[model samples]
Target: MSKELRINSNKFIDQTTRLSFKFNGEKLYGYKGDTLASALLANNIHLVGRSFKYHRPRGIMTCGSEEPNAIVQIGNDPSLTDPNVRATEIELYEGLEAFSQNCWPNVKFDIGGINNLLSPLLPAGFYYKTFMWPASFWEKYEFFIRHSAGLGKSPTKPDPDIYDHKYYHCDVLVVGGGISGIMAAKLSAENNNETLLLDDKNILGGATIYQNNDCFQIDSTHTNYWLEKEIKNIKNIKNLTIKTRTSLAAYHGYNYLLAKENLTDHLSPDERKGKIRQRLWKIRAKKVIIATGSIERPLIFNNNDRPGIMLSSAIKKFIDFYGVKAGKEITLFTNNDSAYETAISLKKSGVNIVSIIDIRDKSSSKIVKEVEKHNIKIYWKHTIVNTEGYRRISFIEIMQLSDDGSGVIGKKIKLKTDCLGISGGWTPMVHLFTQSGGKLKFRSDDNVFFTRQE
Candidate 1:
């Protein structure tokens, strides 16, 4: 395949080493450090899967574990098959086989897609209401429902991979390896404490690593430069143990938790002969810091489940870190100021910024000014009413919000765009805290849920 969507500049990807993989039986090539999602975007293949209920076309929405779409079945071998794997989280490897699920016959032409037209008849409790009358025939109804409900197919044979468990005791345990987590681990280790830090990605510095613009500075140095220096300093700390590709799976009482460490999943089958596939880490820490960052929430619009509609942060990550552009012309719709950062990043990477539609009435922020200075149009108090295109987004219809902010007021204006990035502010990641018996309170200011301080 042609590298049409890939940027020419050298960034995080090692272009010297090329790896070939199969997606729905089509052979594709990607660089060494590219994820399956980034590789797919680089080749302009965004229709990755079908939705669960309506069978609507879905693409890669986010670049991490918070991804709601782009789940696929991995491996052709039954014994090695893994289903419901997030394409964004999987690292690219040679001979990797990925197939779209939840679609009958094929993903491109699925018969199950009739559910989209019949979605109006199928309400939230349609299954329970329709199947409850016939008591004796319930088993027959369940069999048909169960077969069509799930997304991917499970392995018929047992998994043929080795897995082990280990235990560790540390004075300080940091769940997220983002900039905040790294700083906490550094300070703990400097005080001679046994510090342990974990991150789901293979690299450190988190989102800060992708932020290369000079607008952000810390102590007169660029944010990326400062983060790089801090990461280098933390690596020299003796008491700190950094674990990459390790995700915190569960949090128990008394500061106990479980983390899953990926070992050989990123390697080729031939290279993973005797290596363990995964290891479970049972950790006990005296003190814990949950620094897991927030996830970008998408805007609610008509036909929003269509392919090529992704989160704003995911777009920035793909362009800044992976050197891949989702589209040549992009339109961003946001309700807050955070998405302006994505606009700047995309513009700097040579991607066309068609326009930015902000739901608020007006804004005088520096980022907004910067975006307008580049001649990018900003439509304030406007919201998308409809979207066009089937397998991928081709255009969107937007209108100005009413004075009461309850509905659209003006005529719909259509804009042609290949990609749409939406941001509805962020909801703090408090799942681990809530799992450990913590209470949460909703903040009305930003419409986010946060843990209540003790």
Candidate 2:
């Protein structure tokens, strides 16, 4: 059920090898390098699941670890079926079966949707407030409450996968495998340090690897090309060890860390037999370098959680990295310059860019100037007031911001766009840094809290 969203050819995805998988019992096809989320978007399957409380529709929100929706159950076996797995993280494999969660009788026509109408009577913690008053009927209410709660089912039998643990000590440990992490690993290793780099991905190089823009250059060469050359240089460093598909789980005192390294999650069932499925790494490093990058903040508006609404960064990766078009007609909304990057990428791919709605006054940056050259429509000081569409976004209503930027002042203008990409700038990932006895200072300008040093 491919929607023909794929571009002609992509070096990253192996289109020659087509693998079929099941989603809600219907077979779908994806390439060797496609994630379950990317494949669904390619098949034009939005509105994958339903919200837990109100049963409002939910779709694949993000492309990576920060995904808030698109959770599904994998497999049908009593012993091997895995639940609560993020669709964005699961790599496409042969014979894989995934079903949407949090709904009964399927996601499209869930009976639990009645709760949305009853939402006024079922606010947060309403079950505790409404049910506990009559203590005599507690047992009667328990049966119905338990049946209505929780997502996915637990395995009925013992897990049949192998799990192992190991220990190591390194002079320096660098987290994240983006361009910054790659350079950090290489520099640490070059100084005769036993450096270890960890990234929770099957492939190395983060979002920067897919950045093929002409303006993003290094020494007269595109940044992607330059970073690829650096990746090759780090592989030969004897003191450096790079571990992909591994995640750091905990940070303990005395420079001790706990990491989970997946061994065969991406491989097919037959290929995974008798192999270590996952390995827990207990490492002690003299020093730790946390280069865990930032996450793009999303804009908030009425009905912003619609299926076709996604982060601008995610749309960029879907096209440039996965070689899939998010939508045939797309519009972007932003308060920063990042969404312009998405607009440029979409324009280069021969996709129709309806327009760009920026909440701030116009400024002429080099990238913004380049977008102006394309003669794309720009609505300055405008904000999305509401979105329209039942399952996927079909139209967006925008209004010019007031002089004080607190309210709307002009008449609402409606635009037809299948996909809406919104960017609210980036928030630095400082959880690991703050967890290790570090404090943070709130930066209100960009709406981010950054680590503050002593």
Candidate 3:
């Protein structure tokens, strides 16, 4: 972890407080400002979870709502163990317990990992085809399959925490806390728009909090200085409500969104003083500008399900945002420029870089130039043919791809690497827009889904 600490706010918290928590039945400690993800990382616990399919090892991906891993079972009771809850979004509270899912014995050395070797016979939709003929046999197979499938166990007892809902009217509801979202909320609140910024992260500032690239020149003062300034300025604006650690679960008619606020999750599990544990806010907004930004998509290839291999978005949060070393050495593979930024950031951590493989033959991207300046080996028009790793990554075979990056044309180049950060480009988070029944138009250049003007 980086020793250069940067404190961004004193509004919500002012002291370096400590909290106790449990993981996989073991007790641990975390700070007040730490998210469940950061707290887990701080405990030097990697492999916070297991993969959905294949039962592979998994860790925290994105720092905010885009987190694809570190989903765990919490609390002693199955009902209180929040399934699919993002560790990156949960605040650290005393007695908070978490466990990795999808394993019979444990997350590591999962007996289900034997399924990886048997994966050749179990292709995608294998159960759909194979389990049909012996429908009666499927009943028995599904019984074992369901037991082998999914992570975390539900609490058998009823939830002890009280959860409730309330109605809140606001002139502006910012769905994301990214750069654009923060700026938009600032303008709206300044104009007396009764603004409310909603973020799924324990802290705000979405991607800007993680990304270290100079694409937009985000002020590197840490903890989103601009976000703090805007929120500070809006303190007296009577109508502005900044809800952090809140997710807009559902959208109803009249531009109303059902938002869940985790109020006492970061304190003590028993600290609810008649206050709702989780409050559902029914927010009615005058206008909803979805600056929700985008999520990093992983490039599909053979053996991409390996333990250490992860999305480029995850590398940024692990290194830049949370000060956690993602791995000893990293190999970043991408079809775009952002992966280069991940490589550079990791290089600064004194970790060795095996190589940066790009799918493009040539490009004018500034990231390309930066990589060249660092003298890092760049294999253009190359893609991973296969990855080899057990329990963790050990090697990846890179093959030079054709100009369109669809086929291999040159000899294969195999290199030893621990991690492979894959970036297939950004997917626009248009869930809120789609929830509003908005139309969508495809962007050929970006090749991503986006909301269309209705």
Candidate 4:
């Protein structure tokens, strides 16, 4: 449980304020602006919960709303207990109580984990097929099925948290608060258009907000610093309304949308008194800008769902934004140049980067060249065939990619690492657009889908 307390850290987090919280009955301390996932990683507790079918150990794999694992029950009060909450998205606060979900006995040692051994007999949909043989017997099997299902426990008492709804109408609406979203909002407001910018995160600037790299700069200033000034300037704009911790849920006809705004979710329970916990925002805009940004697509390999196997983008965020190191020795695997940026950040933080396994033949990008200058070992045209570890990743098996790019052609090379950062590029977040009847065209070159603009 070592913390990388680099003096350069704390751009987003407040190291001055330490917060104490509990997970699975174990108390831990984190900074004021930390998330449960980040704090847990900082404390070296990767195994958080168990998987659905096999009951395999699941960890904090991502750092945002897209996190599929690390779900848990929040609080123990009958009226206030929230279930199946994403730890990555939840803010860390004093007296915050959370417990792992879907595990009997405990997350560390679960009886359900035996499902992995009996997996052959179970197969996919084994429970459904085996129990459906006799519909008459379903009545007898209903009790057992009901008991084993559900990820978390529902509250028995009525909810006491305050929630409200509101409506807004703006000339232009931006769905993201990233760099592009900030620029779009600034321009729209300066042009006398009433602009509304919404982002799911409690803070603006998206992933680029923490992106600290020499290769990424604007107007001779670092991208993050430059964006800070733009964000500050937008605050005085009369026509602009910036809503952080607000997520656009739906996009309907005539540019009408539904967004959920978290008013007091990040606040302490005592501070939340007389305050609305959440607000449902009904927004209408004459024009909409879909700057929802992209999410890092994770690469699939054997046992990729292990506790410490995370996306490179996530690993970067854990280090840069939260001021915490994901691992002492991390191995990065990628097919693009994105991983190089993560490598630089890790190296700058004094974390040992075991090696970089790249599937691409090579890259001449500035970021890649910078990584080369650091004398970091990069295996070009190489891919990780499999990763080894149960509760967490211990090492990965790598080999040279064949000429046809379909198979491995060399002897297996094993690399020892505590954490694996994988980058499969990114997928454009066009869900709202597609939900509103937008069509997509697949780009065969980089293998991503984009809207077919008019």
What TM-score would you give candidate 2 relative to the actual structure? Answer: 0.98
Error of 4 at 153 (Å): 1.1
Per-residue lDDT of model 2, residues 1-454, tens digit only: 4646888677788989998999999999999999999999989887889898999888887899999988989988999999989898999998889999999898888999899889998889898898996799999999999998898988999998889999999999999999899999999999999999999988888988999887799989888899999998899999999999999988888889999998888888889999999999999999999989999999999999998899999999999888888888999999999999998888888889999999989968989998999999999999999999977899999999999999998798999999999999999999888877789999987778998879
TM-score of 4: 0.97
Tell how far residue 167 is off in model 2, in angstroms: 0.4
What ranking of all candidate models by lDDT puts the best one first?
1, 2, 4, 3
For all candidates in order, the CA lDDT equals 0.91, 0.91, 0.74, 0.90
lDDT: which is higher, 1 or 4? 1
* Candidate with better lDDT, 2 vs 4: 2
Candidate 3 positional error at 326, Å? 0.5
lDDT of 4 by residue, 234-336 (tens): 9999999999999899999999999999888787788889988999999999999999889999987777888899899999998889888888899999988
Clashing pairs in 4: none
Q: Which pairs of residues collide in candidate 1? A: none
Q: Tell me how candidate 4 scores on lDDT.
A: 0.90
User: What's every prediction's RMSD, in angstroms?
Assistant: 1.5, 1.2, 3.9, 1.4
Q: On TM-score, who's better, 3 or 4? A: 4
